[model samples]
Target: MRKRFVMLTSASAGALMLALAAPAMAAPEADTIVTFDVTAGSLDITAPAGPVDLGDGAPGSTITNQLGVVAVSDTRGGATSVWDATVYSTAFTNGALTIPVGAVSYWSGDSLPGSETGGGTFTPGQPTTDDQVPLTGTAITAIPAFSHSGGTGGSTASWNPTLVVRVPITAQLGTYTGTVTHQVA
Candidate 1:
């Protein structure tokens, strides 16, 4: 009985020693990196597609017309975006007959009904008829500098201008055509 007991104790002690000496099972893990990119935007402008026609008037009279809608779009997604719109005109001519560019006047009346949108400060070059400026061969500010202060994404502004042409008393009796150009920067 003693010998049997001694053998049983030896087997139990060997099993306990093996369990303690074995390596423990561990959880495995790995690391991964993540990434992405963002592209830049731009600023643009647009003008009326149709021609602006000032109705006919007798010699030594003035003809006036609306210059349609002109718009500026700033899509640069900038917090402090600024832009200016300039305008110039060529001499009105009918063959040899010419009407001087200085005789043309421009008035940036106001923004069209519900045409002004987004957030920014829009200032017309000519705020009123009294403030009309003479149109010369050289470009002048049609829409003065616009400053985007409290806005997000993009901003836009649009306005209708008035054109006044004074006919000289000695002007010829024919249709006079001139080109008016608008640019933004």
Candidate 2:
């Protein structure tokens, strides 16, 4: 009986050692989904700070001046992003002496040196002096963001425009003031 009891105890001890030596069974893994969100940005435009000054001219003569730098910045990111910049003007009047809006011509020359940044294509509304369009109280495109080759980035474009005014052959002479407005979308 003593011998049998010793053999049974030895077998139990061997089984316990084997169990401790082997790796434990792994628990089932649980998965947690991860996620995030990104919001859209904004598009904006900056016009030159000025009351643009077109120098003096005699009656029936044409007066000209530079409207300074006009800029458009697009923060809205997309591969095919686009926008347009339009310009409008208020008639120039100096107490009874007036310059009609139709007499004002705008020439958006080109993007200034190093003024165009980011990625995309910028098209000037008036590429040259000959392309100048008259202001008739209606908004005309000053610049157009036609295409974007970049993957998902913003773009900017800026240009200096020339304003030409035709002084009517009337008999009044005074300093004329007018408002030129620029808008973008």
Candidate 3:
């Protein structure tokens, strides 16, 4: 699976790059080139932070649901795989990045991240909304927790989706971001 990163900043773009180019009056430029060893890490997907009760209707029709995978499993057998995917929104502030209460579906309260469902050739790490895939983008990454076999041992494969939600920009400002977290449970 291929991986890509997208960071949207109100700044001219590439906020990090501009910060590095800015002058530091108290510092002097040196003709020395320095190199250091570093470690890299993948983006973290925290758990959905909180819940936004969609609320009830005037006649008192209540609406209560949190966004999460409906289920994770196979066609014939396997442990039900579950993912604690979180969705949140952030806004740029002179004060630093901030997190805000995100919007949920009017009905499902599911964050409007994204979803795709159906049968087709899958490209791991190739981002898609196939709701039929696993919570993780890579098929190999998502394993069947439990499995069953006939006395003769013949089990079919199963598929689900890697449900996703985009963090809303309207989210509040803070050092971190959060949103309503709920499970299909």
TM-score of each: 0.71, 0.72, 0.19
Task: List pairs with backbone clashes in candidate 2.
Answer: none
Off by over 4 Å in 1: 1-39, 140-153
Whole-model lDDT, model 3 = 0.29
Q: Which portions of model 3 miss their true places by more than 4 Å?
A: 1-31, 57-185
Residues 1-185, candidate 1: write the lDDT tens digits.
99999999999999999999999977697778878654547767677766656789989999988877778787776666567777888899999999998888988766666765667666778878898877868564343422234566567778878888889998989999888877777
Q: What is the C-alpha RMSD of each candidate to the true structure, in Å?
A: 6.8, 5.2, 29.5
Clashes in predicted model 3: 23
For candidate 3, the 10 contiguous residues with the lowest summed lDDT are 150-159
lDDT, candidate 3, at 76: 22
What's the count of clashing pairs in each model shown?
0, 0, 23
Off by over 4 Å in 2: 1-38, 139-151
lDDT of 2 by residue, 94-183 (tens): 988788888889887878888777755677788888888887575653333122244356787788889999888883788888888888
